[model samples]
Target: MERAEMKMKVLSTVTVERTDDFYKVVDQLNRTLKDKGLTFGFALDEKDSNKITMTIYEV
Candidate 1:
């Protein structure tokens, strides 16, 4: 489905220290969501240096 067509349902917001590459984090999140049969609504990253606060939602 198109991104704009997605319907978001807030799930969880979390903060984590950067332990891996940004792209790797994204890929892992995609894989995890797919495994759970969940659509990835979107993610908001409040990035500050090495710390990232990520808000994850379901579609």
Candidate 2:
């Protein structure tokens, strides 16, 4: 399949209480939204492990 390049944008960055299970939700979003031009990313706050930074991107 031929794909065209699209510009990526940072939709949002949210900091919330961290949980291991959040990875499952992020994974599901990536799988379900990749073709819709949206991607979800996640990272733990380096200074505070109890917080997670969730980033949504447009692609």
Candidate 3:
């Protein structure tokens, strides 16, 4: 029998009124993902806005 492969993807967004808040949010997210045995990918921008986005993919 052949083993099946699975993929998981997660997206998170944070909007902050201050620059420090942005870094803090990202740091928390990284820790969360590390605890979950997940890896971080790249973020995508939708149009042009002040929102920060992140993407994660794992198998």
Candidate 4:
């Protein structure tokens, strides 16, 4: 079967000292997408020391 394509944008904020937290969030997001039969292309951005933004495109 062919996989469905979708586009998703996610934004998250974390303290600089807790940068690792972003990985967990990203992992969960990926899992959610996979469960929905979707693939993701991630565009990551560090808005600041306490802010981050991720844009995910399904391909």
Candidate 5:
């Protein structure tokens, strides 16, 4: 089976509360995309003091 490549496009930008345990959120992001049958292109972390902004892109 061949895996389909995700298009280069901006999907959405999500922000989560700042926390020491960030792995959960990252995992969730991966799961969410997988559930949607989408591939992850890239993620940009734009974090501030109290929150983190993630710009998600399709692969």
Candidate 6:
């Protein structure tokens, strides 16, 4: 048996202020919507300490 490969596409990228509460929203969305083909992720920008790079993807 073979497993099907799922491809992810980046739908949006935005720079936003890094805050604890904001991450809570992203985490909630991922927990609730990931199986529905959408996911949210974030990482601190290498050049900025006060901002985060948020990416929305289609799974």
Worst 10-residue lDDT window, candidate 3: 11-20
Off by over 4 Å in 6: 1-4
Per-residue alpha-carbon lDDT of candidate 2 for residues 1-52, written as tens digits (9 for 90 to 100): 3346666699999999999799999999999999999999999988899999
lDDT of 5 by residue, 1-59 (tens): 34465354667867767677675666777788866654433233544567766666665
lDDT score for residue 7 of model 1 = 77
TM-score of 4: 0.40
10 residues in a row with least lDDT, candidate 1: 37-46
For each candidate, give its TM-score against the true structure: 0.53, 0.81, 0.39, 0.40, 0.46, 0.79
Clashes of 6: 0
* Model 3 regions lying over 4 Å from their true place: 1-20, 40-46
lDDT measured at residue 43 in model 3 versus the true structure, 0 to 100: 36
lDDT of 1 by residue, 8-39 (tens): 77677676675556556666777878666454
Q: CA RMSD for every model? A: 3.6, 2.8, 5.7, 5.7, 4.2, 2.6
Q: Report lDDT per candidate.
A: 0.62, 0.92, 0.52, 0.51, 0.60, 0.88
lDDT of 5 at 10: 68
What TM-score would candidate 6 get against the native? 0.79
Better of 1 and 5 by lDDT: 1
Could you tell me which 10 consecutive residues in candidate 4 have the lowest summed lDDT?
A: 9-18
Q: For model 3, how does the per-residue alpha-carbon lDDT over 1-59 read when each residue is reduced to its tens digit?
A: 33265556554433333343665655675678776756554333465455445555453
- What global local distance difference test value does model 1 have? 0.62
Tell me the deviation in Å of residue 37 in model 5.
Answer: 6.2
Q: List the residue pairs that clash in candidate 4.
A: none
Candidate 5 global lDDT: 0.60
